[model samples]
Target: MTVDVRLITESEYPDWLRAVHTGFLQPPVASDEEARSRRPYTDLARTRGAFEDGRCVATFRSFAQQITVVGGAALPADAITNVTVTPTHRRRGLLSRMMAADLAAAKERGDALATLIAAEYPIYGRYGFGPAAGVAEWTVDVPRTGLDRRWSRPESGRIDLVDGANVRKLGPDLHDRFRAVQPGAVGRDERWWATRTGAEQLPDHPWTEPFYAVYRSPAGEIDGLLVYTADDKWGDAKQPLNTATVLSLIAVSPAAERALWHYLCSVDWITTVKTGRRGPDDLLPLLLPDPRAARITLQADFLWVRLLDVVRALEARTYEAAGTLVLDVRDADGLSAGRYRLDATPAGATCAPTTESPDVTLDVRELGALYLGDASAVRLAALDRITEETTGAVARTEALFRTAVRPWCPDVF
Candidate 1:
């Protein structure tokens, strides 16, 4: 049987949605009204569906976005999401065809990069996607007092607890302000905010009505906000011990971040607090009296970024130390293929083709690894994947390409 690939039309939305929910095992399929609400932001033209005998078997959606790089420049990018294939259609190469078609479309649209939070990691690596960000989950016993002494009494900042539903509106503003100065942070559009907060006039998830707390500095400027929910007696109580969990917490500024942590730790009647999906370099240690009370679990996988245009992707981000390096990138799939010289300084980077002075040669996947700061040039060279001709070119390239902080994405797409 041959599978047909085509754009999903408005009339076919019900079938498409049904296939998606069943394929992904999403509980309780979304209603027609809910689907209608999501239609505006979704690009139906970019949504592809594979069908066998007039039945939808696979589907995916792609949307264009303006992603702000670590340094500050905005680049045209594509976010591939909502990819799912029916069980009956699995291992039939439907996904590969869909992805290839979508990527080709994105390339034709002039997208320089593609990003997504993979539902499964292994499936994406073959597509040239590399893990570009990570989230660290932490647990702490509130009574341990490790956080007590280090926790400075927060200065006067106006904090207002608002309805969680209102978070959809306020989150974008807070995120926009936060990403402006933060390196390796991506921008969130309305659709992204709506999906995260479950507020796009869609069928909502009852378990996820998170509370929003907005923080204003003494100067009366809104600097930070947190979306969180408290879970009481969350763990096994049979052992004579119980715990509380802080489901989510996002702070936009350093002061606001500290204040939010203080508030969470001080919540009464909670023996322990569990916070999942936070920055790898979260400031809890600095604010805690005993840093030992904060137990951090280092877990990988967050956002996967694929460079569609090497020059644009390389030049978009800021460099730490200054240096010039040549990159010989091999793309097995022929998506990103080129040899270019990246001249990077503290200011930014300028990438162009070079006929001489080759410093490093690596594959596109390795380049993706380097771009995310997950694998350094020296490490790749030692692994025999990156070839370095000069004495300290590896070190120089690593230093020049290092991000301001370890790349982390607290939000799962």
Candidate 2:
């Protein structure tokens, strides 16, 4: 069957919404509610659908975003989302066609990279996206874990609970401040904030009725925030064991991080505090007297990055060490496939296409995994995803690509 692919029109948004939600196996949203929910941030110009027999069979969209790189630079990225195709449309080239079109458009518009939080690990690598970072899930036995007394408390910050409605007013500014310093964070527009705070004007949105809190400095400045929800469980022995699950937590400083974790553990009737999508190097372990009380229960890929322009993406971020390497990048899409020379110093980096022999040969996906400095070149080389053509080249590249902070993407979208 022939399928037509084109940009979705404004009049067809509800149908677009239903098509995507249905394809994902989610309950359909009420048309009236969706219409009432304003989505200026949705950018219909970037939304597309695959139509067969006058009905949408597949959907895709990419929002403009600023993704933080090493050294605190926010580079342009196309945040791909709402990717779905009906079950009947599976095995067709719909996914490939949509991804190629979206990526090509993003590249043509001068985006440095494209990013997504992959729902399934194996599907995106073929499209040249690599798992650039990993997040660790923590299940903290709160009762067994005591706050580290030796840890100096925040000088001026105080943690205070706030209502979900208050999050609408405070979350955006606090998040902006937090994102400025955190590598791998993506900018969240107003629409995203509205959705998180349940202020998006949509009725019965998914997620718990969020309990929000903020860490405020003595100077009355918000330094950190946590959004979470809890479910109370009763045991056969008549015990109240409630679980507090952290949906999102952003702390600007180490002090704030410690304070927020402590506060979460201290919540009344909470037997366990769980959080995920936090960087592997999260500080909760360091914040507790018994570090073992907080166990890493799960760890896996989080942010997947795809470089749209090899030279631009490589040159955009700050480097830590001085080195020169030639990379022969292979891309199935042929968008960023070529040999390029990268000269990186602690000061900055410069990259351009080169005709010289390559010191390393790898796929563009591996190159993207190395982009944020979370994936080590040596590791990828050992995994056979990357090749070091010369002796010590892997070591040299690894040293140069190391980031000061382990990159983590806290933002879901």
Candidate 3:
């Protein structure tokens, strides 16, 4: 049985769409209304499919994205999404065939790296991808965690609780500013903003009515946005405690962050406030009188990265410490396999192909893990995923790659 893999043409979009929905076990989007709802999430030209007997059996696509690396440089990234293979085509190597073509196309298009929210943890690692950054779930008790100077100093800004309709104007600009300061952050496209902020509705996933708040800075700049929903609940003692679940909280400045959290905690009848996601190095717990105030319920890798162009990806981001190290990077697909020397300084890193002896040896996956400045070289070496070919190489590599704020990707896509 032969499976043909290629980009779906404009005329074949309906079949391609159905194939993707089916692969994910979603009901066929049969009507005009349904199609319009789903259209924003897809780029028809970029969507790839695997056809067996003239029917698309697998689906894949990537959004045009720029991910912020260490030192505030945005690297061209292909944020892969809508990946699916129908159960009928399971274990047939359809995924591998499609992934290879997609990755090659992305690299040829000059995207330095590829990123995705892994539907399954173990699948992407073999494709030269590694778990780079993760999300943390915070459950905070509203009663104990007061907003009085715990999160930040007294703020001159005020949070105005707005509606979903108003978010259409404020969200995109605010998020662009927010992703800039954080390393490993991926930019959200217009489609993502519309669907996520409740400006547009999609099929299967019903938009839950949520409250939107805008944080205005002292100088009257809109810098932060928060979207959340509440469910009124009471304990056995009839306490009027409701639950406020934070869907998305984006703040461009420390003052804006404090104001958003302060507003949520100050909401009337809110018993517990929960967070959708935060970075592993989040200072939420420390902001309260009790360091153990926010209980992190879930801690798991949220973003997986694949270094498609090793030299390009390395040179795109800046390093903190100054050093020179040669790396022998092995790529299973041979796309980025080569020895590259990386010279680092406070300014930026310059990486190029070199014939020099490597001080460290590793696969593209481990390098992807280190690309964002989260995973340490010594840690990977201890796990045998990385090899230190020279004395003191691991420590030197660690010092060169350390980032002030651990990388965190806010958007799921």
For model 3, residues 1-413, the per-residue Cα lDDT tens digits are: 79888887766677778887887777854455666666656677678888888888888887788999888889888889989998888898888987898888888998989999998898998999988887899899878775553343235877787876678777878877877888888877766767876666776577788888898987889988888899978889988779988888888887787777777777777868898888998767776666566888989898888998888788878887999999999998998899999998988888999999999999999988888888888889999998999999999989988687899997776
Of candidates 2 and 1, the better by TM-score: 2
- Cα distance off (Å), candidate 3, residue 182: 0.7
The lDDT of model 2 is 0.85
The TM-score ranking, best first, is: 3, 2, 1
TM-score of each: 0.89, 0.92, 0.93
Query: Which candidate order results from sorting by lDDT in descending order?
Result: 2, 3, 1
Cα lDDT of model 1 by residue, 1-413, tens digit: 89998888888877887888887787636687767766677778999899889888899998876666666666777888889999888899888889888888888789998888888878987777877776777788778845553443467786777775667767777777666655446667766666556654355444467666777778876777766666545446543234545555656668888787776676555567677677677777667778788888656677788888998888888888778888777787788877799888878889987777677777776777678565567777888978887778888878987675777655554
Candidate 2: pairs in clash: none
**Which digits, one per residue and each the tens of the lDDT, describe model 2 over residues 235-340?**
7898868999999999888777878887778777778888856888888887788989898999989999999988888887878899999999999889999999
Q: Supply every candidate's count of residue pairs whose N, Cα or C atoms clash at under 3 angstroms.
A: 4, 0, 0
RMSD over all Cα atoms, model 3: 2.5
Q: After superposition, how far is residue 242 of candidate 3 from its true place, in Å?
A: 1.1
Q: Which model is ahead, 2 or 3, in terms of TM-score?
A: 3
Best by lDDT: 2
For all the candidates, what are their Cα RMSDs to the real structure? 3.2, 2.6, 2.5
lDDT for 378 (candidate 1): 77
lDDT accuracy of residue 54 in candidate 2: 77
Tell me which of candidates 1 and 3 scores higher on TM-score. Answer: 3
